[model samples]
Target: MFRGLGPEIEHRGEIVVIGLGRFGSSLSRTLVDMGHEVMGVDLDSANVQAHAGVLTHVAEADTTNEQVLRQLGVAEATTVAVCIGADIEASVLTAVALSDLGVPNIWAKAMTEPHGRILSRVGAHNVVFPEAEMGQRVAHLITGGVLEYVALDEDFVLAEMTAPASLVGVPLGESNLRRDHRVTIVCHKPDSGRFTHTDRDTVLSPQDLIVIAGRRKDVDSFGPSRR
Candidate 1:
């Protein structure tokens, strides 16, 4: 993701993550596993100590303090992610401090739409709502036919769903999905086998999972009735 940073930057330069909650901790650990230097920070001493051995560096500090951030060299990191979703004040203050310190990349977690807007206004390069996104995914999964759903954006989605009874044994070419539902089948996975590229001639079975992409509304309407 930081490929645009170029090779001039030292390889050992770290990615600093503040607020060692579930999202922050998981992101730090994943970056470490991917062989990148990571520094995890939190106001809670226990959170910092919990990840001491797992992360490259662990620090306990109030990230909203510009002095503390500067002392920790937060501005020198390749990127900084502010993960204090529950505390809007801290999240916004931390982002502002990072921006003032000239951190090139700043990501933040927001608890609500208004919070996200505030974070962006305060110089967060990216704002993510993990809880809201997960809620949408789980809602789709529980909607009967949908096996999985991924939101590509606010309006578009990629979904995998069971072949509806109406579509069972029908050749893909005759389904008229593109014309009627405004969706395109990307692939199909049988219950017992790997996914295969789908073509017009491919026939869907009741047990098969069809991966489709289109507008969120269209994709939702393409599948069978929910249980």
Candidate 2:
């Protein structure tokens, strides 16, 4: 008899995801889609029931209790993620328990910078602020021009934007874009076709989606302004 929805112990490669709330469930589902086995845990029965059919395993357990986690075979997992949101104390305690259990890889979500630092100090190998990161990313896109934006680093970004009229028909080598704009066009996609790599000889067509990479300011300036 198992306390969860699946077998008591899964194969070695499975990931232990603690918390079945929005973030945890979304992550676990994605992992499952990617061909990874995910064992999901949550204190809320509703949350557990919601993901019972999606995850490889679903359990209602207090991950802060090392014994319970051990009983669930979490100690043998190579990776564990603590997606406990709102409750800082429970998140920290769960992280501490995971560390004490010697889980090799620990990823934890934090609501704030201070919370992230605390999680890192308590042995979470990676601390992520999903809400904060998404907010910042949306802020960039809402300013206009860019259709998609990904920050590769604090000052670097890769962005997608529609081709400007001035660049259409002209080969990229003759456009002086890199010299004048300080950004590099990495790829382009026709409105009806898939994206392909770009080179200096590539000619832009009006409204083609171009992916460019450079320092944040440079790429932002090169993007066409919202019409």
Candidate 3:
């Protein structure tokens, strides 16, 4: 339940998303699903109303106006995401407006390096090039998403990885990894980053981020090098 789509409303640690475009709309919905109360605003009335149930607050306002921002309780929000696409000026203005409102954490979407720099100057706490960042992460595991990455320590290391096709149908104990490969399957993550190493009955999914521990070299060679 929310009131006053206008700016001067009071707020707690709510997440406010500006610009109900494709990416922004999706993120707003996801935050709602995660049990967070989200406030989504856009210049278009249709866009704001379309995502009514998914957000705790929805408004159609001209984000460039400081009064509009003030009424939305931007100063009280814990975080704000500015997602205006194609309009670099609008994005920067909104970022400045939110920061000026005293919102501590401001996240702005950048279309280019220059846009990111401008966002920084305007006081956005974080600037994200969503597509570029995701592309770089995806490129890390081009070979069918086997192991994500490995962290090495003195005697043991933590391997943040996913199950290779080689281990898809294989059970944890059957690997004989501790004896042969000298590695231990520390944890298994499944669907949505929720994990349970004790649930041995649960089959492994390609989506899992299994945490394995062992000597650095052994962890690499112990399993198939590439998925």
Off by over 4 Å in 1: 1-13, 225-227
* Worst ten in a row by lDDT for model 2: 1-10
Compose the digit string of candidate 3's lDDT tens values, residues 1-227.
00111244233568999999998998999988988899999998999989887799999999988898898787778778899998888999998888788887778888887888888888887777776555543554574444454333224555567676655666766655577778777778786877667334445667666777787578657546635
Better of 1 and 3 by TM-score: 1
Q: Please give the range of 10 consecutive residues that has the lowest summed lDDT in model 3.
A: 1-10
Each model's lDDT: 0.84, 0.85, 0.74
Tens digits of per-residue lDDT, candidate 1, 1-227, equal 01121123333478999999999988899999999889999999999999999998899999999999999989777689899958889999999999899887788888998888888888887778888889989987886677888887778889987777766788889988788889898999987988999998999887888899999888887765422
TM-score of 1: 0.88
Candidate 1 differs from the real structure by a C-alpha RMSD in angstroms, to one decimal, of: 4.0
**Winning candidate number (lDDT):** 2
Q: What ordering of candidates by TM-score runs from best to worst?
A: 1, 2, 3
* Model 3 residue 18 distance off true place after TM-score fit, in angstroms: 0.7
Between candidates 2 and 3, the one scoring higher on TM-score is 2
Give the per-residue Cα lDDT of candidate 1 at 143: 63
Record all residue pairs in model 1 with backbone atoms less than 3 Å apart, i.e. clashing.
Answer: none
Clashes of each: 0, 0, 6
Judged by TM-score relative to the true structure, which candidate is superior, 1 or 2?
1
- Report the lDDT tens digits of candidate 2 across residue range 105-124: 78899898888888888888
